[model samples]
Target: MHKITIMQMLEKYPELPPISQGTVSKIEKQFRKRGHVRQLKKNPPNKLSDDQKLDVTLMLEENPHTSSCQTTSALNISHSPFSAY
Candidate 1:
């Protein structure tokens, strides 16, 4: 019986998306160790809450020309939601 290598399997499938062989090896290693292929998604630490979102929206509605910096400063938060982009 022949053992199919990562490179050999990748080469066998030509239409697969471009990915480094090293990455595939790491994923295989991670799955073996953790029994999962993907890591848990961590929520952004600086994400705005519903009330904060409403505040920003209301502020914008009051003044369309208001910048994110101005809105964030008025809302008493340091991080700008726009800055994340």
Candidate 2:
């Protein structure tokens, strides 16, 4: 059996996205103590899904001249799913 340090694993997987050394060390220590690490999923509660939010962001970005009243109306229409009880 082989025991590998995170620094060694990171060196071998440099192509992975970069995280601060301190954050990585903290996660590693938690994993060692708990025998596993729980990661935050790409999605979170109380927020619109990525695709839905992206659509609204792009719409506003491409039409920066849109009025606040028009944006509000569009948002109300697009997010009508939440209006149902």
Candidate 3:
């Protein structure tokens, strides 16, 4: 069974109807579980790696007074995961 990474989806399906990252992730999960080809299995969106997250975290830890919003900006996080949904 071929494992499709998130990066693959965004690249291959440029014409796929616009969808949210959450939705794309959800579908990818199912596709992996079923070991099936997904519609968006090519050119997936850019996702942050663990290393990137760690780098962001470390940067924040180094600065005590950094605002969460500012940190997020510095980390290139488009949306605040902590913000109220």
Indicate the residue-level lDDT of 53 in model 3: 69
Regarding TM-score, does 1 or 2 come out ahead? 1
Evaluate all candidate structures by whole-model CA lDDT and list the values in order.
0.74, 0.62, 0.64
- Most accurate candidate by lDDT: 1
User: TM-scores of the models, in the given order?
Assistant: 0.44, 0.28, 0.34
Worst 10 residues of 3 by lDDT: 1-10
Write model 3 residue lDDT over 1-85, tens digit each, in one string.
1134445655788776545667767766786788875555577455666776676668867997887678777777754452321
Model 2 lowest lDDT segment of ten: 76-85
Cα-based RMSD of candidate 1: 6.0
- The number of residue pairs in model 1 that clash at the backbone is 0
Better of 1 and 3 by TM-score: 1
List the candidates ranked by lDDT, beginning with the highest.
Answer: 1, 3, 2
TM-score of 3: 0.34
Per-residue alpha-carbon lDDT of model 1 for 18-74, expressed as tens digits? 566677778788888989987779887677778878887889899999987888888
Residue-level lDDT of model 2, residues 34-68, one tens digit each, is 88898646853344556656656777798989765
